[model samples]
Target: MAKQTAKTTKRSLAVINTIQKLGGATLDELTGELEIARSTIHLHLQTLLEEGYLTKEGAVYHIGLRFLNHGEYARSRKKAYTLAKQTVTELSDRIDEEVEFVVENDNRGILVHESFHPDSHFPSKERHISTAPSSAGIYYYLHSVATGKAILAELPDERVEAVLDDRGLPRQTAHTITDQDDFIRELEQIRDRGVAFADEEYVDGLREVGRRVTGPDGSVLGAIAIIGPKYRFTDERYTTELPEILIEYVDDLETEISDSYLDDYR
Candidate 1:
């Protein structure tokens, strides 16, 4: 029984590794590479798909659209995914942390694109990145994240005040700035610094640093950030890392957005 379990785990990991290496693979390609029995390969693939790590399109087994939902949304922006992806890709490499593109949904900040760490530094022992966005209209408050601060920075004071009035600044942590007046001032600081910081504000032991994602005209479209656990992202590290990464990311996104706008004109 132990041998059977070991064999299954090996085959399962083999199937997963192939998909990871290729980004996507056909059933035939997998069968050729995996020395495991065909039944074993099929079983592992089924499990991977069921676990939301793999997706099959027609005959092509690929990483699922779950990972791309955010990218799709980021792509749908004025610039589209092509440009945003470059920034997203770079952010992941530079920081070795999860990087994402987020946008505003009604009154809430929504994650629209996400890029994961390379297999080397992944937090999960369960192979493959499974992060997916919570759908819109779910009522996550604006003060819940640094992502929110980035979104808020773009707002006119009156509009910002309105959102705050509707959603009181409930504290997520003692570190969270909940006072309306203080929060508004903090938003100004974010604008001046060109970044937003969540010092364990959203989730304790988790931290994120964000900057406003803008369209071609410098209109803030949403927010983007790099995220990780607190152990790896201490405040000092965040201050040193986030702003630089975010600034470069936003610059890349802007170029893509500009080109996308011009494509429409032509």
Candidate 2:
């Protein structure tokens, strides 16, 4: 019975993955990919379709809209998302740029929420806002982008080392710091300054400034960033003007999140 259950679970997962990879697939395509009997594949597809997990359109089967409902429900439950929903708009209006609220999920950075100013112009489809990195055409690297660095700065030295070991510092652009020692030193500087800056490291003609917003216990909850083109982000403002204001916004977010979310648990 246990073996039968395990086989069923594996078959279901393989069918879902194959459909996802092909975008939509006919029963023949699924049978060819899985090398399973046509009758068994039809039975599984019928089960999934009856459960509203898959939708059939003539000969092809596609993932159903039920997953979007699940995705939004999961997103709304995050403490970071709840807190950022109320404040990211104001931050975007104040900065006159795109504001991103990103969370550290495992070793990858996930953009949970984003607010854009009326004047903000997202240059490309690849550069627009999204939670999914693949859809957004953005790379997730803790050592490269400002939001990733801000979260990395709050982690202990050992945890940071573990991340480095697990995912080697791959270069995104010429300015990216690939050396482990240099990246460690950069984290130290961010810890001291309470802010992290990515100066054309992640992209050739873009810049970002970020700060970590932590809970009362100093655990990193998320990071907020102000992102824009390099030409608009002058060195003078980045070093002197922006950091102070960015830190103030981050501090306010931290206080609000701590009081509203973390205090309840305590």
Candidate 3:
């Protein structure tokens, strides 16, 4: 009975995750994608709908907005997220560039906050900002982006190896480092310099500089990054100017987080 219950729970959660990834799914689509019997999929879907975890329109079922409440509550529990939002916003406005705060979860980087400069403009082809209401909640492979790499640099080598074992080094662009040894070397450089740079590694023509933030307890919190077009991120700015500014902002953010929370709290 215990084993059966566990299996059922896993299937139900899989149903929810599949619907989320598809944006919405019909009964047939869910059954086909999950390779479960139609009757089993229908049972799972109906249970989720009754529990208000899903909403149906016509033949399609979608992830319920109720998840928003849970997501927001989870985000609110993170003091760094709240503080980073304000810090990134101010930093973006000051630099007239885009800024992002991202945290590691399940070995993936989750964007917690993103801010865009008021006067910032990108060529249509180079626009990397999402059209969604907010770019928060998006996930990225830790090996792909500057902020993710910065956070990875702060993690222990064993943990980093475990993450790589799970996610592997999938190539995101021509410049992305797919070799594990090369990525490990890159992380060493980031640790030495206290910053990470993504030169069209995750997205074409976009460049970013990132620094990790730590709590008062010296635990890794997340990372902050400044982003812009390649033309704007010249060698001098990308390697020197922006990295220095990011380091300063992240240092200040770390101090504020430490001051605002008890040393034992985090």
TM-scores, one per candidate: 0.63, 0.79, 0.92
lDDT of 2 by residue, 145-218 (tens): 89999999999989898888988899988999999999999999999988899998877777889988888778
* Model 3 residue 106 distance off true place after TM-score fit, in angstroms: 1.1
Q: Each model's RMSD to truth, in Å?
A: 13.6, 4.6, 3.0
Best by TM-score: 3
Question: On lDDT, who's better, 1 or 3?
Answer: 3
What's the CA error at residue 96 for candidate 3, in Å? 1.1
Q: What does the lDDT read for residue 21 in candidate 3?
A: 81
User: What is the lDDT, from 0 to 100, of the residue 228 in candidate 3?
Assistant: 83
lDDT of 3 at 88: 93
Determine which window of 10 residues in candidate 3 has minimal summed lDDT: 120-129
lDDT of 3 at 39: 95
Candidate 3 structure quality by residue, lDDT tens digits, 1-266 = 54446879889989999998888999989888997789999999998899888999999999988888999998889777899889999899889998999999988999888886755545532345355657788888999899999999999999999999999999988999999999999999999999998888888888889999898888888999998889888978888988888888989998888878865465
Q: How do the residues 13-130 of candidate 1 rate in per-residue lDDT, one tens digit apiece?
A: 7787798677688888888887877777888888889978788888888876565575446456544545665777777887788877777676776655667786324343112223
lDDT of 2 at 12: 80
Residue pairs that clash (backbone atoms under 3 angstroms), model 1:
70-112, 70-113, 75-80, 75-81
Worst 10 residues of 2 by lDDT: 129-138
Steric collisions counted per model: 4, 0, 0
Which of the numbered candidates is closest to the native, going by highest lDDT? 3
lDDT of 3 at 36: 77
